[model samples]
Every structure is written in C-alpha cells, then in structure tokens.
Target: MAMDADLVTAGVLVIGDEILSGRTKDKNVGFIADYLTQLGIDLKEVRIVADDTDAIVEAVNAMRACWTYLFTTGGIGPTHDDITADSVATAFGVRIDHDPRAVDILTRHYQAGELNEARMRMARVPFGADLIENKVSSAPGFRLENVHVMAGVPSVMQAMMDAIAPTLRTNSALLSETIDTGVGEGLVAEPLRIAQERHPEVVMGSYPYLRDGLFATKLVLRSREQDKLKAACEDIETMLADLKGQRQAQI
Candidate 1:
C-alpha cells in the first residue's frame, strides 16, 4: 500500500469525574482528532471513565492492546483525584516512581512555591516510561508501552500532541474539498454514488445545512492522494452543476 493508503489508528481514554458528571464537555477528543487527522493518524475509538483505578487500568490495557497508539487525558494532575500514573503502572505491572526529569522540568520553569509535595506528585511515572516533552507547560507527559499519558487541559493536551505526534507512524492525510450546492441531498444521492464508484479510493458525502430559510448541501470529496481527491471533487461539482441546470429547465 502507498504510504498514503495505509491506516494508522489510535484510541483515547478520557479519565475524569467532571466529564462523567456532565460538568466538563471533554474537549480533548475533537482537539486530538483534528490534530491527529492532520498528521494522518486515525482516532479509532474513545472511552470515557470516571476516576476509578480498576476502570482506568482496564481501559488503558484494552486500548493499548487494540490501537497502534493509546492516549489518556485527565487524572494526572496534582489533586487527590489524580491516579492515572498509578493506574497505568498497575496495568503494565510496573512500579510508579517520581521521575527526576519531570521534577527538573517543573523545577526550572514553575514557581518554587508551586513545587510543594502535592504538586511534586505530577513527577511520578511508571518505571521505564519515556517522558513526553511539553512546550506550553514544563511538566511532561509520559509513555508506557504504546500508551501516551497526557494532561486534560486543552492547551497542555495540544502541546503534548505536538510533542508526540511526530514520533508516531502516520499515513498520508486524506485530502478533502467541499462545494456548496443549493440543493437537497436527496436530489444528488444517485449521482454522488456514481461519482464515488468512479473514484473507488475516494470517499464522498453530502451534508445538508439549513441556514436561515435556505437549505444548502455541501458535497465533500476526500482521498489520501491529492490528484484523486481533486478529480473526485471535480466530478462531484460537474454533477451538481448538471442537477442545477436540470432544475432550472424544469422551472
């Protein structure tokens, strides 16, 4: 398969009480999805679990085993509910210890006042885990086996994603283009399917958006190769143009 044709998959484990209780909307999924999609990594599944050790461990193990890479967000901070590091260690049967590198990263940039025992808890990592660099904040995330543990905050999560994304294998990004058609999806379904068959590698879809009183449709064509995507888009545009002409003639 072409580098662009292969699929690289990942899974996300979101651990928190706020998310499960509906207090937090869990913004990490869309952020990570967009980021990884840009890098050609597909996010296959996402699991949200409360702050429970067994649940965290099971989810960590399961996702790591299933996906090419696994990521966990939340429950790694300084607070009492933070137990991700310990749970991850338990899942991998490793010991969790305070990593000097993490402590050093925190020590250099963060206020010494904030480096108290509670905050120092952030330095802990599973034995043999590799630290993931964080540019936005000094405190680093870490990786054990295929699982990459990251912070929950959107800003910090993005930083960690930037740090780790380059290290993973990625297929070529699926190039996509959209065209606005002031027509309903129902009218274009058959032609769209024909276009899809013409370019078997490209995935095409129509989205209907109701704005004000006008119902408009957007035809989206996506493929890993730029040429294929462009060709598919051109074909879709032509079909839509034909449909418009037919409608005008009918009136």
Candidate 2:
C-alpha cells in the first residue's frame, strides 16, 4: 500500500536468521509500533531478512530510500554473524571501522583486559555515522542518514529508540474512536462501504467479536483530522440505528 505523504512514515527491517527460523521470538516490532504511534510516525512496512550481507544491504537500501525513516534490528553483536553495521556501510558506500567513541564506551564497561576481540567487535561502526547510546548496555548503535541500526535484544533496542526519538521529525497524532454496533458485518456491509468511499481520508473498519457469548461488530474509525473522523462515526451510527428500526418494524 502507498503511504500517506502527509504523514511521517517509517519501515522496519528485521535482520536475523534466528527470527526467520522461529528460534528467537521477536519483541521489537510491537515495541516499535507503540513507540512510533505515540510519536505520530506511521509505520508503513516491515521486512524480515536473514543475516546474509547481500540481503541486509538490499533491504536497507530499499527501505531507507522509500520511507522517511528506517529502523533495523538484529545482527549487531560481537559474533562472526553479527554483520548489520558492515552491511549497512556497504549499502551507503562508506568505510566500516572500529569507532573510537564506541570503543571508549565499551572499554569503560568491560573489566581490565576483559574486552576481547569478540567484545571489541561491538565498536565497529560506519564512517560519518553518529553513535546511539545504549543505556541498557554500554555498546552503542549508530545512525547513518535515515537508517538507525539497533540491537536485537528488546531492552537494548528500546534504549536506542529512546535515544534517537527526539531527533526524528514527527507528525500530529492519529485519532481513533471505537463504537460497538450490535450487529454483524452482513448488517453494516453496505453502509460501511459507502462510508469508506465517502470519506477517503478516514480509516474505517469493522471488527467482529464475541462478548459474553453474544457476537457483535465494532466500528473503528481513524483519521488525523478529528472532526472528519467524528462525522464519519456519526454517519455510521445513524446508518446502523436506521437498520435496527427497520428490522423491528418488519418483525
């Protein structure tokens, strides 16, 4: 789907073989959604790619080019397979090396002589990139242009998000209202379609659910313009009420 040009849109590139293999349960996507919703940034797309360098580079390049911002998670660690920083560097055509700022932070955290080669790998970052401080762990993430490289661990990723949030361009919050319609999709299908076509700016949807053994349909209306959303909601309620009265009279 096409993104709304009026909104600040973001894409998530999840890079890790473990996540695709179902070995690791990813917790970052939900965290990011809630975080972005609060900041008024629309998350338009999400992709999961393996730890392969080529795949990571291609996904990063596409997402960074298309979206206002791209947040990447996983593969930034001390292991041989941790290649996100270097792959992102390849995508941006920049030199990758051990950044001293990151080194100093990790150095201070590790005990004397405890910062081995594996641990030191965390210091590697792309040229011209700025460090994203990790309050959960001393190791840092990096920001290169529109892409923000973060940790795979949920806590560390959250810390990185908090660090870079204030720097991002945000939009006004998307407003939403949910009203229960004591009917099913069959009863409101035509009206819902008409409402959606009439108000293209609003996101109108019906969700079916069971409450205390009784089924009902919930009308969820969303829009950045509060007045427009309210009007669409009122129209839907009136349509449903008219249908109810007609049914009672026919019975």
Candidate 3:
C-alpha cells in the first residue's frame, strides 16, 4: 500500500550482544517511540540485533531504506565490542576514521592522559556524517544521512534524540481516544469489527484486561484526522450503548 506522503515514519535499530543475551535490559526503544510520537513521527518498526558488523550493516541498510529516519542505540562506546560506527560506515560504503569534531569534544571532556587509544575509538565516525551532540557524555553520536547512531546508555541516547529532534521532518500528530467498554472483549469484538469496517480510516483496537476479577476491554481509536477519529469514537460509543441495552434486556 502507498503510504500517505504527509505521514512521516521511523524505525529503531537496537545493537548489542548484551541485549540479545539478556544481559542488558533495553530502555531506549520506548523512550524514542514516545519522543517521536509527540513530534508527529510514526515509529513503524523496531529490530534488535547483536553487535556483529554484518547484522548491524544489514539492519542499517534495510531500515534506512524503508523509513524516513532510522534511530540506533548501543555499540558506539570505547570498548572493543563497540562497533556500531564502523558497521554503519560499512553499510553506507563510507570510510570510517576519527572525526576531528568528536575527538575535540572528547579531548575537552577528558584529562590529558585519559584520552587513550581505547577512548579514541569513540571519535571514529562515518565519512560526511554530522555529529549528534551527547550532553550526558562527551562521546558524540553521528548522523549519516537518515540514520542516527547514538550511545547505548539511556541518558546519552535521549540527549542525542533531543539534539536531532528539531532538525527532523514531522507530519500531523496522531490523535487517539480510549473507551472503557465495561465489558469483555468477546462481547465487544463484533461491534468493534463493525466500527472498524464502517470507519476504515480510523485505527481501532480492543485491549482486554481483568477488572474486579472479571474481563473488561478498552477500545482505542486513533487517526491523523481529528474529525474522523471523533466520528468513529462516537459511533463506537453508540454501538457499546446498544450492546449494553441488549445485555440488560437478556438479564
């Protein structure tokens, strides 16, 4: 299907063997999703890959081509396993070397003897890439085309996101309304399906949960168009009201 030109979309790539091995719990994906959503950018997909160069390279190329923007986290550190910058360089077929700007930042942040070879690895970036500032740490992230590579630390990644947010292209913010149906999903499924069919533009979903030891559902409707979302929500309310009446009659 052809995507709406007005809709801006993004993809997230999380890199690290620690994450894959369950050694590190990821916190950046949800943060980035919320951040992008507020800016009217839809986060369409997320991929978690190990710290392997081939895997990172493949994910970078695939996601960057598929979405308007691709945000990556992890593997851009001083350690030997920190290979995100190099992998991204390979993906773009660009030369990887110490970016003078990044090196300068690290030099300023660290002491005379602290900026060793291991630490210098953080300065390496793909050719022709713009630096993404890291307020938490001196080691900066880089923006190579549409792909943004940032540190794995939550605080640092967030800072990079803030640095890059202003420059991003955004679309209309998605509007959403949630209705507590006060009933089970099974009872509301057919009605929700009908409402979805009637208002094809609105995205409708029913989330089932336990309330007071009984089944309950929350129906959420979302759309970029306010009028359509409001209309669809009203129709859903009416359907739920009718369903309630029918249940009472049966009782």
Please name the candidate that would achieve the greatest TM-score relative to the true structure: 3
lDDT of 2 by residue, 129-169 (tens): 99998999889999999999999999999999999999999
- Candidate 2 positional error at 78, Å: 0.6
RMSD (CA, Å), each prediction: 3.0, 1.5, 1.1
TM accuracy, model 3 = 0.97
Best by lDDT: 3
**Model 1's TM-score against the true structure:** 0.85
Residue pairs with colliding backbones in model 3 are none
Model 3: lDDT of residue 11: 99
Full-model lDDT for every candidate: 0.87, 0.92, 0.93
C-alpha lDDT (0 to 100) for residue 178 of candidate 1: 84
* Least accurate 10 contiguous residues by lDDT in model 1: 1-10
> How close to the true structure is residue 31 of candidate 2, measured as C-alpha lDDT?
95
Q: Tell me how many clashing residue pairs each candidate has.
A: 0, 0, 0
Compare candidates 2 and 3 on TM-score and give the better one.
3
Model 3 over residues 91-177: C-alpha lDDT tens digits?
999999999998999999998899999999999999999999989987999999999999999999998999999999998878999
